[model samples]
Target: MKTMLFSILAALLLFVPNAAAHTYISETTPQDGSTVTENVQQVVLTFEGKIEEGSTFKVIAADGTAYTPQSITLVDGVLTGTFEPALPNETYTVKWDTISQDGHPLSGEFGFTVNAPVEEQVIEKEEESTEQEAAPSVESTQQANDEDAEKSTSPLLLVGGLLVIIIIVSIVALAKRKKA
Candidate 1:
């Protein structure tokens, strides 16, 4: 009976730390794997618990350029970081490394694409067709518009779908860990 009691106590002790290992991200600005039409000057991540001061956030552009925020401020479990002017039409990944309140290190990476404005896309196409012998017909322009819309929306749908799957899996894993 003494041995059984000791075993139970040991199991409970081992499970406690795992349960409190890290704080979960309650929400984030721009969301994970989303596309923003407007300029994004900053990234904000909100956690369910407090984050330590030593936490770091990084922004990496698709061209292999990495940027550190000009400022990082933590207030009421929300960490906000300001960066330079909006990145042009490109995908960027925000990588974060932070210590949870429990002292465990947690890190994650999320991506967002900054899409060019509709006017900008139209201007670029106009410039590209400057050398053409004939003006584009109305039907051809309509078809091009449809194609562009499809191209832009397809990636967003894929990314959104993947994010949903990830969130569902994470919730299940967390639930199981908490139950343990």
Candidate 2:
């Protein structure tokens, strides 16, 4: 009986650390092995648990251009790395390193492809020139002003409604007190 109890306790101790092991990447933007048609300005990694401050990631293009992140931030178990000038058409490999909450070092790598067509770039340039030449119409300006007014009034409307409710409740409470 003593030997059996000792074996069971040893086995339980071995499994406990594994169960509470380091956190891992639960989800990633531009998911691994995916082909995207749009510009990728940021990469986001969501971990199974909160990550430490030193966590970061890098992007390497197929042409061997290494794009370091302009900024890295962590919030609620999610790490985001933003890159300037967006990623062009290329197959990219993302390498990341992070420290888990348990003080263990963790790292991973994933690949994705960006393939934005050249024709869209030309069209976007043409649209920008045309929009620049066009002046804002009177009706559009009025609509924008109306939208701003609505946004500014929203909070005021909510506060007014709450004040009215409070006054009504106060009056009812005073009436009940006199009756009692």
Each model's lDDT: 0.65, 0.69
Residue 100 in candidate 1 has what lDDT? 85
Q: What is the lDDT of candidate 1?
A: 0.65
- Model 1 stretches with alpha carbons more than 4 Å out: 1-5, 11-21, 118-180
Candidate 2 lDDT over 1-180, as tens digits, reads 444454445444433322444677767777777787766668888787888999999999989999998899999878988765567789999998988898877777877888767676456446647774321111100111233235435555665566556555666666787799
Query: By TM-score, how accurate is candidate 2?
Result: 0.61
Quick one: best lDDT, which candidate?
2
What is the C-alpha lDDT profile of model 1 across 1-180, one tens digit per residue? 444454445444433322344565656676766777755567788777888988888889999999888889998778888755445577998888888888877777777787758675456456546853221211100101232234435555665566556555666666787799
Lowest-sum lDDT 10-residue window in model 1 = 135-144
For residue 129, give model 2's deviation from the true position in Å.
12
Q: Which number leads on TM-score?
A: 2
